[model samples]
Target: MFGDIMGMMGKLKETQQKIEETKKRLDFVLIDEQSSDGLLKVTLTANRTVKSIEIDDSLLDDKEQLEDYLVLVINKAIQKASDVNEAELGAVAKDGMPNIPGMDLFK
Candidate 1:
């Protein structure tokens, strides 16, 4: 019984290490999105943190329209980031929990 407990603890530590490594890899994953009209662009990490934005000069003169475009572009960027995160981290999670039936659905 004691050996079994020790073995499980060792597996738990290995799983924790894998999760941490996946998170670190996710930090380097970036998704870029642009508005349909090419007027705005945004870059974000897989965790949905905005990294940068690029706007066309033509939008500068119209503050209201620019704001709208920025919102649209940012939303697209965030969504893309979410998809990327799900695909990447989801695989890691599935690999870690291989014995759980239908575990892939968790993503």
Candidate 2:
């Protein structure tokens, strides 16, 4: 019985290490989103860090509209990044804790 417990513990530790490694890789996962008119674009990482913002010169004449579009595009980028991050983390969790009841909730 003790040997079985120790083996399980080892497996748990290994799974935890894998989870950490996966999280590190998530830092490099980028999500890009752009406005419908292609006036604005945003790049964000799965870790919710904004990498870059791009705006077309055509929007320069309309400050108010430009600000609105910027906000819209930024939110869209963040949402996309968040969705990808959740999916990746869910995959990790499913791998680490297989066969548990309600585990599909992670998906």
Candidate 3:
């Protein structure tokens, strides 16, 4: 009983380490998004850190339009980054989890 508990603890620790490593790796995974007309573009890392934004000269003339484009494009980039982050972390966590009697966590 104690042996099983100790093993589970060890597995949990290893899983935590893997999760941290994955997060660090995600910092380099880039996600790019642009407006439908391609006037506004944005880039972000899987860690959801904004990397860059490029706006057309035309957009610069219209403050409201630029703001709307930024909101739309940045949100799309963030959603993509979030998906990647979730998938990577979920896989690591699921793979490292110890199989307990009734816990089908990954299902």
Candidate 4:
């Protein structure tokens, strides 16, 4: 029993170390999340910090309607970036990743 406990402790320590290492890697990694409409793009870091946003040139033709569409695109991109951030964090502690009630993690 004592040996078994020690073995489990060792495993836990290794897992903690691995998680810390993975977190460090996240600082240098960039994750891009995009809108389906493809009119606007937002770049975000793995930590979910928005780095930049870009608007497509085609949007300039219709200034009035373009503003509404741009808003939609920005919202979509932000949502995508949030999802990506959650997914990346989940990847580190994958074993403990939760399953949403009635929702699928694997697409």
- Give lDDT tens digits, candidate 3, residues 3-94: 99999999999999999999999999999999999999999999999999999999999999999999999999999999999999999999
Write the residue-wise lDDT of candidate 4 on 1-107 in tens digits: 68776776776676677677766666566655445777767666555566777778887898986777657655665666567656665666555333435646544
Whole-model alpha-carbon lDDT for candidate 2: 0.83
Clashes by residue pair, model 2: none
For candidate 2, which ten residues in a row score worst on lDDT? 98-107
Q: For model 3, which pairs clash? A: none
Kindly indicate the candidate among 1 and 3 with the higher TM-score: 3
Give me the candidate number with maximum lDDT. Answer: 3
- lDDT on C-alpha atoms for all candidate structures: 0.80, 0.83, 0.97, 0.64
Ordering by lDDT: 3, 2, 1, 4
- Provide backbone clash counts, one per model: 0, 0, 0, 0
Of candidate 4, the 10-residue stretch with the lowest lDDT total is 94-103
Candidate 1 lDDT by residue in tens digits, 1-107 = 68776776777677778878877887888888998888888988888888889989999999999999988889878888888887877677666653435545555
Alpha-carbon runs more than 4 Å astray in model 1: 1-5, 98-107
Highest-TM-score candidate? 3
Q: What ranking emerges by TM-score with the best candidate at the front?
A: 3, 2, 1, 4
Off by over 4 Å in 2: 98-107
